[model samples]
Target: MEIIQIVGLGLLTTVLVLIIKEQKPMFAFLLTAFTGITIFLFLIGKISSVIQVLEDLALKANINMIFLKTILKIIGIAYIAEFGAQIVRDAGQESIASKIELSGKILIMVMAIPIVSVIIETVVKLLPA
Candidate 1:
């Protein structure tokens, strides 16, 4: 049922966007954005549930909250970056899309430094000293 709904919505939007693109490019772009937001809205509940499960699992595993949270944030950035890049690419701005992806990667790497340092320090402590 979910697949059916998603496919139906996707097909409907595709037809609508294609038909409207020639007459109103701006409107087509707005329609595409609206459709994307709508789909994201539909998935928000699922996203939250997944986040909660991850948080609980991390807690149970005795993982540091800061590191876990940072990792999740990095993952979120990657996903959002990919989404934005795809949208830009769809609008025929491949160069800008690539830039956006690069920025996301840089941000993720910066955010991961603390976790990486912790890992490195732990490994060093475990070595014969």
Candidate 2:
């Protein structure tokens, strides 16, 4: 049902954008951006519920909350960056969209540093001295 709703909205927006693009390209871009944001907002509840389930599983498995939180932040950044890049690309700014994607990858690597360090340390500890 949710997918149907999302697809329907997307199809409708596409038609409207096509119609307005020739007359007012800027307005068409704005409409596309707004619709994308609206869909993202509509799915926030579902996202939160999935996050809650992840948190519950992490707790049950005795995983570190900090690591879980960091991973979640990384995922959030990836999705947001991709979304932003798509919008920019839709507006005909391929260069800017690529920069956005690059920024996201850099941020993800930065955020992953601590986890990587922890794993390396654990591996070192397991090796013979």
Candidate 3:
């Protein structure tokens, strides 16, 4: 039922955007952005529940809360960046979209440095002195 609703909304938006694109491209772009936001908002509750479960599991596993929060922030940045890039592309700004994606990649990589360093240090510790 959820998939059906999402698909139906997608189809309807496609039709509306197609029809309005030529006459009022700005409006069509706005519609696309609104649709994206609406979909994300619809999923927010589910996302929150999933995040809560992950946090609980991490706590049970004795993982550091800071690391979990950092990972979550990185994921959020990725999703938001991709969403923004896609919206920009849809509005015929491929160059800007690519830049957005590149920025996202850089940010994600930067955030991952701590985890990567920890892994490297762990491996080094395991090596024979």
Top model number, TM-score: 2
| Total clashes for model 1 | 0
Candidate 3 lDDT over residue span 1-129, tens digit each: 777887888899999999999999999999989998988898899899999999999999999998899899899999999999999999899999999999999999999999889999999999999
Computed on alpha carbons, the lDDT of every model, listed in order, comes to 0.89, 0.99, 0.94
TM-score per model over all chains? 0.92, 0.98, 0.96
Question: What is the TM-score of candidate 1?
Answer: 0.92
Better of 1 and 2 by lDDT: 2
Per candidate, the number of residue pairs that clash is: 0, 0, 0
For all the candidates, what are their Cα RMSDs to the real structure? 1.3, 0.6, 0.9
How would the candidate models be sorted by lDDT, starting from the highest?
Answer: 2, 3, 1
Give one digit per residue, the lDDT tens place, for model 2 in 22-86: 99999999999999999999999999999999999999999999999999999999999999999
For model 2, the stretches where C-alpha displacement exceeds 4 angstroms are none
**Candidate scoring better on lDDT of 1 and 3:** 3
Clashes of 3: 0
Model 3 weakest 10-residue run by lDDT: 1-10
For model 1, state the Cα shift of residue 94 in Å: 1.2
27-108 per-residue lDDT for model 1 (tens digits)? 8877787787788788888889999999999999998888878988999999899989988877889999999999999999
Candidate 3 Cα deviation (angstroms), residue 129: 0.3
